[model samples]
Target: MKNPNGFGSVYKLSGNRKKKWVARKTISWENGKQNRKIVGYFETKNEALKALANFEYIENSKITFKQVYDLWSKKHFENIGHNRATNIKSRYKVHLSVIDNVSICDLKIKDLQKLYDNLNLSSGTANQIKSILKMIFDFAIRNEYIDKNPIDYLEVKKHKSVLERKIFTSEEIAFLWNNINLKLVDTVLIMIYTGLRIEEFLNLKIENINLEERYCIAGSKTEAGINRLVPFNHKIIPLITKRFKEKNTYFITCNNRKISYSTYRRAFIKLMEDLNLKHTIHDCRHTFATLMSNAEANPASIAKIIGHKDYKITEKIYTHKDKNELIKAVDMIN
Candidate 1:
């Protein structure tokens, strides 16, 4: 009986040899020549044929990330409550979706690390996502889709306390300015100059920026913060202009896509570690507040600029005066 095309072959070699039956597969072709690999040399044709069959079966059975996740969740979901299962599914969609079509064998630690580092998740949420990945890799290993789990090598560091208002010193600010070309340092500089919350800066859209006027409208997380006008610090005008010209929808981005908060947080942490600076993302806001206060900038303007609705007088009364005050306050940061 003839074998199917590309199924590989088992045949006896002409040379005198201890094991004459050879099983080989054509892996590639170059210069009109077949580049093949011998699976094995066997004592009998049947043995060689069996080896080829096993090789083909293994090659054909390689599973993808999505496939293994589906298989794993079937039994996993059955054992857990519907709500818990749904929550796992949600995390998988948000965090693991990037590698869905990737084969389990091809998935690498760096691939996982890139995704993990880019997210701005809390420690609990980060651990939850990591758990889901660990389960999928374990499933793959048990099923023989892959031998080693890449997740075993990954290290997820604990998040620092963001509540600590440890502001950057003038010396550290000078150091950052000198090293502005470093990755994400510009982001930190922007945060310091503009006094934006991490999320607010990340969500700043192109439409909200006025490059000519040197101001942007952005805010969130509070009634006072919503759509407030923020004047740009003179030092960061070039930085903002550079980002604006990228034509991205958001002012801050990674690979032309909206960078998630958790990813940025992780990268920010790494940056701090590299620079040997002890601070949090929220610290940039604190630095701004401190800079403004130290400069003796107007309290009304400071309150408005930082999006605090704490002024005794109604913000409606100072709206016109505050715009000029906000610009003046930003300039005073020097």
Candidate 2:
């Protein structure tokens, strides 16, 4: 069978064998040298046609990868949650320059693999790049700009290093609470008491805290976007209530203006240095989960409080349940 464009050919291989399809595009260089390139070879005509159609579509759109990516980024900025949109824009600015000029359909998995290999980037960073590219491709496809995502076939290498899940001991927590200034102390305290992410902590509003109900309704950054109501015991209620008079906006920020992640991270690092603590801000969240598990809180309940989808996520990430509580779990095993 001949291609619709009369630029390629397809043939049946043999009995009990599939058909072979090939696509070729020829062009003359600036120096008048002719070049013929094989765009793709597929086992099925349908697959070949799909690829050809994608190529044709891209060529016809007359849109550069940069143009499409910019459009995607703008739409993404408008659609995604604020924190997520910020992260996507930051990542794209850092790693997407190389492929910005190429057409979307012409971006091969091999090209992406090579770009990833040369970047000297961490697996997590590479994965983020892949994710951003996938998002852009999804946008393109949804808008009928392309037929398939070439990025789907690319794989990111996994880093074997396990993340540190440090949980502050009760004594350490008391030491931190006593030493730090009142302004920043409650931020850490809230994270330890509620297992909320630092981002979530900064985003919390006065309305989320219901003194009458004794629970704080907060949104998590997980895929499901779970909004959990964490019960505030007598201890945490007074701490949050005291701050109610300061501002009606976020609990952590001073001016109600959104603080960047780097700003908070730097502040936490300075705080840690002053205290001579070896733990990260995330450890406060871990400490909350550990303390809860030690208090014999149910795994499912802990997961719910932390906005995790299920107990498995809580267990997988916070592997170090308090030893005494672990013993109780162990006792049940036998």
Candidate 3:
């Protein structure tokens, strides 16, 4: 009755001290003085003890967003390569990293939604951020930091005018072909016909291509972007043959290692300036799908060639407006 532990003392202080149990724990010493905190009040001793145990565990083991993210970043990006890890970290530093000190249990959907709203990222990037956030929260939940993930039911949505994948019109494709010089013409044609993303095309090593098979393995990022086979057009054959003649590590070699995306991007910018054309390199892939669809290529074949897991996507997002066909249909409607 004289000596007591800070966990809580339930002694008769008044007419046989009421059976009031106060759950308490010492977080730390402040200014060389032991500082105590009251966790909660319970009706029974066992309840108070149980509460104290939970409070101790949570207080001692609470994971911050930084810790969870660090753990997740290592596992998710494991063996993914340095470039990808750097890219992932860049994205994280902008949003997720800001809340590094915030406990995962304290992470709210609204907190995340605010970050998303302010990011001004494209639909794809915003979705990616959301995915990573949800994943981190899921990890937190598994570790018992929180019972449920706040992001699991979060209602964050992409803006209506979010930047979408830019597709090149048929005429634009024709113009690019006409103006593409010999230096990078093969690069352009390979991209246009194979539906390879710029990164995929630029990063292509000899192992990723098969001259005899007339197909190139290209992809990155998603499931559709890994080890996907892109069949060549009749036109890309000659170009591939020529490139094969030159011994190089990457398909897009600039005298040595595969030309960096930045260096080549600047060159592409200069070419676009000279041609007075405005389009991202990704437009080439979109142009490929559009051209394939216009040529009445089977949807399944197009999806496979483009490495799309969902074939319907080719019909939905890849198809572009045909004014002539629209006019014909409208005339029938009238």
Write one digit per residue (lDDT tens) for candidate 3, span 140-220.
666456788878777777655544567666676677667655467567767777788888888888877778757777767
lDDT of candidate 1 at residue 5, scale 0 to 100: 84
Per-residue accuracy of model 1 over 166-212 as CA lDDT, tens digit each: 99999999999999899999999999998999989988899899988
Better of 2 and 3 by lDDT: 3
RMSD of 3: 12.9
Candidate 1: global Cα-lDDT? 0.84
Q: Relative to the true structure, how large is the alpha-carbon lDDT of every model?
A: 0.84, 0.67, 0.68
Model 3, runs deviating above 4 Å: 1-81, 85-116, 127-158, 182-185, 219-226, 313-334
Worst 10 residues of 1 by lDDT: 54-63
Instruction: Give the alpha carbon lDDT tens digit for every residue of 277-304 in model 2.
Output: 7888889878877887787766755766
Question: TM-score of every model?
Answer: 0.53, 0.53, 0.50
TM-score of 3: 0.50
Return the TM-score for candidate 1, rounded to 2 decimals. Answer: 0.53
Best by lDDT: 1
Candidate 2 lDDT score at position 264: 84
